[model samples]
Target: MKNRSTELREALEEMIAVGTLSPGQHLDETELAARFEVSRTPIREALIQLASMGVVVIRPRRGAIVAELGPQQLVEMFEVMSELEATCGRLAARRMTVEEQQALQAAHQACKEALDSQGPDDYYYRNEAFHEAIYAGSHNQFLIEQARSLYRRLRPYRRLQLRVRNRLSNSYAEHDGVVQAIISGDGDKAAELLREHVMIQGQRFSDLMASLPQLGKQAA
Candidate 1:
């Protein structure tokens, strides 16, 4: 049952990422169940999970609808995300154990492999693990929970960001800077690199809109 829910959630998230399931569109459980050859039980469970992640809105009587964040809202969220990640990076640089640092290096290597040998979709999944390692390395339970909550809300949009042209290579290079700063125990440098990495600004924001036209249209 857990696997079924997770599978449905991933499939739905991919559809959302690619704009097949546009924001604000109602999710018909019956149709989804038929399409996936599954029971409504799994579909409902998946929608519930998506709701918790901010991917869908579950209404009292109207059922589930794909979530839509306006441009301003998205920018606001990104701003907060940047600060949270910077904090994680700073703490991780100072607090991570030798084993944790080794794990982080392993995650970074996996991200490098994904960038070289896989498509944007594969890179997106690896990126999640890469960021997760930093979050765990922070070794601060309260900060970890806070970062995890925001991370879940931003996951789908962040996944779509990888579709931007040449983003995989560019992001990998940026990750290298972050890893170096963290490895050297330079908290301030790690914080700065992480902030810049997560904060979408100017041209980067433009690229994001170009990559995801649905967001552009919605924000317009």
Candidate 2:
């Protein structure tokens, strides 16, 4: 079974990712303890783990607050993410076992079902699994670790982007292309598709920027 600290950390992470706890919002240990019906020690441990993940900041005097990234920083991070995913795709195309390819397809199918039945939020979670399957297919431990770390830090923004009009459908369609390329052992094509799938540029960038204030207002 998962420990209390792990459970609390995941709960808090989801709250932040879904914008129930918006960026720059304070995380008070006392309030969190009361809310979770736990003591302060577990809350503090959870916050420390979140801090290590770049999801929250812990200051000496001010305690903990959700970490905030500027527009430029967000874009730069995505650019790096795109490159990392592209490499994963390329390697996976050449390296993935038959079993791993089957797993990736299963994950893609799960995303489709989530999109049809439960909409964007459900699709987002399944989509994460789909991408992680590709990450594991690469068989590169170091690359997988780096990709997951950045992916976790960017989870909230990525989730918010799916709220944009037609983004859910578009993302699912992109996943189709990525899956086909990898399964066909087309490394170059897989890399290209993965890069485009993850990169937030042009209108997507504008949409993300426009949506941030709305999320903040909703959180408020």
Candidate 3:
């Protein structure tokens, strides 16, 4: 079972990701505690965790507020995430053990099941497992830590991207290409596929921002 703080954090993050909590909006501890049927301590802890993830800001006097990321900032962060994932994919192609490969296949299967079931929430959970398997398969501890750190920071935004119309099917297709390349030990292909898979660019970025209009706002 999840801890109170973690569950509250996830709920708040989802609300922010789906635009229920707009960027820069104030987070009232009393209101949230009442709404979630929790005490102020858990709310404070969740807000602190969100602050560390760059999802919320904790000011000395003003308390907590949502953190805004403009499109350019989001693009830059995605670029870094793409490169990190590409490195992991490239290394995994060459270094993954047989057991790791089996695990990756299992994760992919789970993702496929979720996709076939047409549950966005389920797919998202399986998708994270699939990517984490690839990261672990790389056998590079430092790279895994870096990728995971960035991944945690970007989780909400990435989850929001999945809410785009028909994005789940498109994402699953991309995952197929990536999985095949990695399993075949095609380092270059795996790297390229993984890079493209995680990096939302050009028209895709524009469309995502348009779909979630709250995400594209300029910092005030």
Candidate 4:
């Protein structure tokens, strides 16, 4: 049987991704258990795991809900994500095995091809794969795990922000810079470039919030 905790986690993640369990929205354990056809124990376990990953907040009487990233928190996320991505780039440039380097290159090229296809959605996941390849290439499992955690926490916002005007092409261009720096074995440069690259997602989200003030309301 699939692990109950994993099953619950995946179900909760899907709820968050699909807007059923929106940011700042309260999560009713009973409702979730009913919705997922699972027991409350696994639901609670999954929520606890999501909390550790910063995707949800669990309050004593108030219960758990998707995390609400305030302006300051959003900025902090951008800053932290940038630093983490840059570090991954630096480490990858220094320690990536030959096959890993090739894999990263292939991921980057695939993203490029997706971008050339000219649809926003076409390139989004491909670009994600490119960065993930870099994260793995860093040769630090702990860092990779942390980065993945943060990435998942930010996925809902990232998916929405990506749909903004011509953002896809712009994102592709940023990836180009990151790719060049990494491929050249310039660790510091790759680190700096990747840090800068990840910041664009923050900017896009910020801009979206500025316009859709309601969307910026507490995660719900």
Candidate 5:
């Protein structure tokens, strides 16, 4: 079972991610404690954890507030994320075991099923698993750790991006190409495909920027 602080941290993280708590909004320990039926200690702990994750900022006198990333900062992070994923794809194509390859294929199929029947929210979970499989297939511990860390930090933005028009379908199509390249043992091809698949550019970048305000208004 999870500890009270851990549970609160995850709850708060989800609230922030779904925009029930908007960026730059204050987080009051007393209010959170009352809302979650917990004490101030746990709420403080939760806020501290979020601060460490860059999801919250703890000021000396102003308590805690949700952290905001500028467009340029967001884009830079995505660029790094794309390169990490591309490297993982390249290495996995050369290094994945038969079992790992099968796992990746299974994950891809699960994403397809979710896309067909369950909509973007459900597909997002499967999509995460599909990427995890590739990260593991690379068999590079340091790379995997770095990828997972950045992936977690960028989770909310990634989830939001899928809500863009036709993005879900386009994402799955890109996954198909990536999977094919990796399974065919073509490292260079897989790297290129994965980089393109993960990069946010041109129209996608515009769409994401346009959607940011909507996310802020979601809880209003």
Candidate 6:
């Protein structure tokens, strides 16, 4: 049962990633169960798990739906991500082994090469690897898990942002800054820089989302 639930979760996550199921769209359990050729029981369990992880929302008598990023949710998520990144940076600086530091440098350079190629797809993949390397280098299991969870939740939106105006270049510079801070073993500086870098991007996104009625207004 657990295995089926995990499989269902992965399949649904891939569906979301590929845009097969657009954000905030309704998900039918019967359709999903037939698609997966599994019992509805596993599908229900998977949907509940995804809801708990913020990947989807389940409304009473309304079935399951993909989570849409409104102005409020986006801003709140970025704030959470900012804190997580700050914690990752601090831990990476203090706990990173010599090997891990070197790997971080190499990862940054690889990402830079991808950005230099001027391909969004290549740059996006490399950028993901770079951040994952930092998360792994943090050496805090709980922090790493929390960061990964939020990261997956934000994946669709973040993927969209990679194509925003000059966002890729801007993100490259931020990644470089984080690498330098971590390599220098300056935990406080790393934490501070990470917070500013992430939070500022969140505010910028919030401003954009605010102008659209499709995205709900963020509360003060």
Top candidate, metric TM-score? 2
lDDT of 6 at 1: 47
Query: How close is every model to the real structure, measured as TM-score?
Result: 0.85, 0.96, 0.85, 0.85, 0.93, 0.82
Better of 3 and 6 by lDDT: 3
Ranking by lDDT: 2, 5, 3, 1, 6, 4
Candidate 3 residue-wise lDDT at 177: 91
Assess candidate 5 and give its lDDT.
Answer: 0.91
Provide the lowest-lDDT 10-residue window in model 4: 211-220
Report every candidate's CA lDDT. 0.86, 0.94, 0.87, 0.78, 0.91, 0.80
Worst 10 residues of 5 by lDDT: 211-220
Residue 42 CA displacement from its true place in model 4, Å = 1.6
| Model 2: CA > 4 A from native | 217-220
Best by lDDT: 2
Residues 1-220 of candidate 5 have per-residue lDDT tens digits of 9999999999999888777887788999999999999999999999999999888999999899998888998899999999999999999999999999999999999989988884887888899999999999999999999998888778778888988988888999999999999999999999999998888889989999999886677667
Predictions ranked by TM-score, top down?
2, 5, 1, 4, 3, 6
The residue pairs found clashing in candidate 5 are none
Superposition error at 100 for model 5 (Å): 1.9
lDDT of 5 at 13: 90
lDDT by residue (tens digit), candidate 6, 1-220: 4599998998898666545676777999999999999989999999998999989999999899988876677788889998998999998999999998888888888888988888776776677778788888899889899998988887766665666667778988888788888989998988988887677354567544543332221111
* Model 3 C-alpha lDDT per residue in residues 1-220, reported as the tens digit of each score: 9999999999998777646777778999999999999899999999999998888999998899988778888899999999999999999999999899999999988988998898877898889999999999899999999998788767768877887788899999999898899999998999999999999898789876876563534222
Which residue pairs come into collision in candidate 3? none
Candidate 5 Cα outliers beyond 4 Å, as residue runs: none
Provide the lDDT at 159 for model 6: 60
